[model samples]
Target: MTGPLHEQSVLVVGRAGGIAHAVAVAARDAGARVIAAGRHRQRLADLYAGEPDIAAEAVDLTDEGSITALASRLGSLDHVVSTASARARGRLGDLAGDAVRLSFDTKVIGPLLLAKHLSPRMRQDGSFTLFSGVAASKITVGTLAVAITNGAAEVLARSLALELAPLRVNAVSPGVIDTGAWDALGDQAKAQYFADIGARNPARRIGTPHDVANTVLFAMTSTFLTGATLPVDGGEPLT
Candidate 1:
């Protein structure tokens, strides 16, 4: 924490793992005053202790009052990225109604609330970036909540771009990133699955957290880009 983002302030929500973790690192390295936000206050403090100019802020996506309180604490923001998401992965019938609604709360409503409260504190060239997944394009079974929520996130970004004009709004749709999202599959099984999927990808490799994070950095700095959903999926869509 060295490039165009030097001295800029960026707040990345959902700093617990994977792509969000990498994005925070990338932004901090780019010299931005990174604010790592999540529901767990102690977790963020412990996780970001090794970094300089990175602060920890607590927020709950489902709670508007929590977001409002967090907003008052941040002085100014150059970029805001919400990688916050919740999903209940199972057949539609197996999932409860509350689970599906919660997914939308994290994926769609959370970002909207952020824009509502944080927009006023943003710089003239500031931006908001959201995280989405390839499930929006590649529909699969037992992932109904994931697919629907991610798709809605894309639309939310685009819609907000128009409403939050002059301030850019965009999303990164990552595909099969090696971000421990599949750790439940077990180490050996996860590795083999990645390799098999990589072989079919146009990029000839499954995505890494860095790949997605780099794209997020782009979305943050590219002033002319807005209402766009960039697919950093290693061309997995082609397969």
Candidate 2:
């Protein structure tokens, strides 16, 4: 509560992703010890390859046993953050069951299971930050699954916050961030998407990874803040 997370340890799930990687790096720079977990062993390794204070662990959050094992390995935890998600964009009727299940598993079940397993290991003053998305509050045609899952995540965070007491719990909802994830869309589609969102947002630009990362860092350090869903969406919520 005094120093800048120095000597503290943080467990970041889905650290291979752009936003998650930024968060891990920022936390480490602030003098915190970081343990990053993701399914991609090589990616996780590459992320923290030379970082002395960072450790990378490959984990499959979809499996309850895997989550439990990971939690068990971290005997004690000071902070927990998750950016896990199985994002699939498709029309409602065209979407497959597997895709929907994948989305739910990562975005909803994974975070919940992680929280449940890691709760005991967390220090009384520790914190848990989960990832949600603007889709939860904004309507988009083909992002139905994502929206639903994110909304569920927000609700879960709120409920967990109350149950966890002194262990703060919250969700960070990011807007359309310029992470490599958007590369999946064609240049034309991506341009139009960004233009639309940017015009609507008061900030007048798409968000950056740092925008979300800063919010996550703030949530982790603000001891009195709990059960909050902070939107790092470039003021997109105003629209």
Candidate 3:
């Protein structure tokens, strides 16, 4: 337990899989105690069973009370990374009000509240890494709600970073990573989609959960870095 984050306490809030799980594992491997929290505590616990370094906790991002309670439970923390997002995908006419609201509530407002309650307990030298996405910059149809939510998240990171001086606040914006998020496209369709995106993007390949996890860890440890949205998106926005 003598890595860069040795003995530090890192909290990663999101679902059991995808980027959150990767981050929790990465942090633990880096010698930090990790807490993987989400809406379902038992499910998260089950997902991370037998992982001594990673303990599961419960927190409903849509509920302020839940965020407050989570903060109370962890009296002190060294760093926090929130990868929670509820995307509202569809055209303008197809979008539902509830879905859009939930998208913002989960990704934007939830992290804001996390900063509100957690900052008091976080070490001044600690940091918060919030999740943004390439959609914010790519700006294509069917991703309007997602883009706006991510845009707001980036802004939130900057705002919080300035307000919470010495306590770094940054964002990690990933491109189309090969995760369950794309499984909705079906096997063949998803493969084609990834292929198309990969062929066009500068990196020429889809990102992985580990790709994002590395950036999250960097954000936590890079003391000089703050208020910036680090893009893990294979330069997709440039195309």
Question: Number of the top candidate by lDDT?
Answer: 3
User: Per-prediction RMSD in angstroms?
Assistant: 1.2, 1.8, 0.7
TM-score per candidate: 0.96, 0.94, 0.98
Candidate 3 TM-score over all chains jointly: 0.98
List runs of model 1 lying over 4 Å from the truth: none
Candidate 1 vs 2: which has more lDDT: 1
Rank by TM-score (best first): 3, 1, 2
lDDT of 3 by residue, 1-239 (tens): 77989999999999989999999999999999999999999999999998878998999999999999999899689999999999999999999999999999999999999999999999999999999999999999999999999999999999999999989999999999987988987999999999999999999999999999999999999989999999999999999
By TM-score, who's the top model here?
A: 3
lDDT (CA) per prediction: 0.90, 0.88, 0.95
lDDT of 1 by residue, 1-239 (tens): 36879989999999577888899999988889999999997899998888888889999989999999999998989999999888778997899889999999998999999999999999979999997889888888998899989999999999999998999999999898888879999999998999999999888888888998899999999989999999998877677
Weakest ten-residue segment in model 2 by summed lDDT: 1-10
Put the candidates in lDDT order, highest first: 3, 1, 2
Tell me how many clashing residue pairs each candidate has. Answer: 2, 0, 0
Model 1 root-mean-square deviation: 1.2
Task: Please estimate how well model 1 matches the true structure, expressed as its whole-model Cα lDDT.
Answer: 0.90
Instruction: Please give, for residues 69-100, the per-residue lDDT of candidate 2 as tens digits.
Output: 89878878899999988887788998888988
